[model samples]
Target: MKNTIVVAGATGNLGHSICTELIKAGTHVKAIVRDSSDPLKVDALKKIGVEIIEVTQFKEKELTPICQGASCVVSAVTGLHDVIVNAQLELLHAAIAAGVPRFIPSDFSSEFTNIPEGENRNFDLRKEFGQHLEKSSIKATTIFNGCFADILRYNTPLFNVKGQTVAYYDDKAYWKIDFTTMDDTAAFTAKAALDATTPRYLRIASFRVSPNDLVALSEQYKDKRFKLVDMGSMEGFSAYNKIQRAQDSAGEDELYPKWQQAQYLYSMFLVHHEALDNDRYLDLMWSKVEDNI
Candidate 1:
């Protein structure tokens, strides 16, 4: 019998990509999604042979049997309070009850273990989920792939292509940041889900680069000089922290707070660099900054 894998948030960017990769690897995929998800996205997954199970809510009693017979459960749900804290936790319990051996939570960012709490809101939510998972009986695997390379490629504020500018939290160019394209992250995640030997925590980077390196790559690819903006380390972090505080007060329903948190997260990556696990998966093909540019 073939290996069966159940995926949550299957219509999402990273989740959809993971489903595609799993299908390519010949694994049986069961995509658990909300009934109100985009019909077009659902059709796309169905066209590719994915088994879709629509649920109104993520209750453990309803989810456990959906997870039955699956070897692993991969969640790519993106959110802070309700989805990550409540929904994903419910999914973990259901997976455990159904006897799934591995549970991969939606941790596709930098190593939050080293970053102090409250520095980044998104990382903080993931950190909380990590703590919850640690206390559970099911084995877990986390994939840390730094920032999304493809998002930065088109997002000019982060990696300004038209303006030829790169923003940094500090004046000096001493920090090294890791980046992985969504496609690469998804492919690696699919492989990790199927591999029973995968460790509890895994890290991978398509390219590890500094601010100067980013400017060089932009100049080389665009054939022009790129300007660097020093936003000041302490000042940037303080501003982002203020935004986080506002978010905490405003509750999770507001979009602007989450958007502000995203800005802070990109800025935090410049000042805080953590250990990477890029070399662990030798068979995976990583993307390069120049290639993305």
Candidate 2:
């Protein structure tokens, strides 16, 4: 439709992909960046003819004008949730002021609004923020697309061959949860933002996979079986303690980035070992991954 779209945090993994998707959809895309000095990613966006908006600091006064006449804003800014929340609040205020039609907050982790523990202090910040958007008369869509499958390679030592074996909730036990590829998540989010009927909470699963299934997939790729490492409740807490100690020794400045710490302390915020039975929502699962492994 050639609607003007602004993608905040366009340099991040999800942001980059979302911006790319918007461009591919023939939307006039604006890549908003926090750092002008990082030209590599900026250059990539420029190659695709995406307009660039670099801000040394986030200011509502500055962005409000930029968002004027825009159709939608897809926020893929990952990292600390608090900083993201604050920045998104600024974005929402600006979008409302600018009369932007729709605002999609970066709710990529899970359907936090549906989870019992998600409504509380530990995990409901983003959920509540979505509510705030509705109260303000903005059409906002929240997508819950489970964990980034790629994060498993980076976050868990279990998948890193050079590190300790992949650990799970209990040794050799599997937890069923939804997983979506980064590209799929980006594409689906863009689709949701543009779809007029898109609900406030958009739940999706490109694939319903479990830790056990992933282990099998990895073994298939490597042609070897790795031993399963177990991290029980106590062990999980021990790992958390170790992470906390590391963060403490490094100093408050280096401590858990708000999002990572939030994920650690309140993992219930994510797509856990529960199955999603929402049939009203389309599954939109990509067939490539199904045949890949």
Candidate 3:
């Protein structure tokens, strides 16, 4: 375990990808999972040479031993309050207790650090956990990789390739939104995990495209003219998003509700990672927007 990396949420899409990348680099990885995790996924990780550790609870005493001597512990788990804030807190303390020097929290999204609090619920939870992570004696690194590029295929209004349209608001037709493919994020993360001197925060994006750029890319890839639709002003859009959040109290019970998606979209417009750390990992094969389209 001294030279090995431990990954929480190893069964997740990003987590699995990270493990594969680390294995490719000849890094020993320990995949942490709950006793209730799917066996098939655990088998998949084992097949790839990842050492699996099953735990009943994410408590410090429980996980500290599993984390002992790990060069880094990566948290790829995603969820609401209980998981994001509470679960990660337990894992963080455990990693520290185990003497892990570096920690990579599951803060993989828009660079909400620049954005004020209360804009996004999931981000709010991340910020809450970040405050705790800050006080810990361990060094931490957070990757803010805008939105995942795979969402483009989901036919959202922002980058609807199937509908051949890219929508914008507040005359932000040219505002670039950051996006990183899950594979690319995983690749960089794997590299970072192996390197113990990584800084506190690293920003990455596979491709940053504005609405107009997306339209052009979509048209070229799909062989169809993509339309650019200006939805409204930023002020109006902000008001509308706030209204949706207020009206949809039921969304609080649901993970990734419509309003939460709206908040992500709004954050996309609001924040941009101007200085990216892509150069930090030169061996990485970054993905382009067209590659995903």
Please report, as a residue range, the 10-residue window in candidate 3 with the lowest summed lDDT: 233-242
Q: What is the C-alpha lDDT of each candidate?
A: 0.82, 0.66, 0.90
TM-score each candidate.
Answer: 0.91, 0.78, 0.97
lDDT of 1: 0.82
* Model 1 residue 189 lDDT score: 94
Query: Model 2 residue 121 lDDT?
Result: 34
How well is each residue in 199-273 modelled by candidate 1, as lDDT tens digits?
888888888777788788777888886887785675566666666677577645653375444544554464334
- lDDT ranking from best to worst? 3, 1, 2
The digit string of per-residue lDDT tens for model 2 on 105-147 reads 8777765665554222323557656666778878887777766
How far does residue 136 in candidate 2 sit from its true spot (Å)?
2.3
Task: Mark the regions of model 2 whose C-alpha exceeds 4 Å error after superposition.
Answer: 35-37, 114-128, 155-160, 170-172, 234-270, 273-293
Q: Can you list the residue pairs that collide in candidate 3?
A: none
Q: Please provide, for model 3 over 240-290, each residue's C-alpha lDDT reduced to its tens digit, 9 standing for 90 to 100.
A: 878998998998888899988888888888899888999997878889887
Which 10 residues in a row give candidate 2 its minimum summed lDDT? 262-271
Q: Which candidate leads the pack in lDDT?
A: 3
Order the candidate numbers by TM-score, best to worst: 3, 1, 2
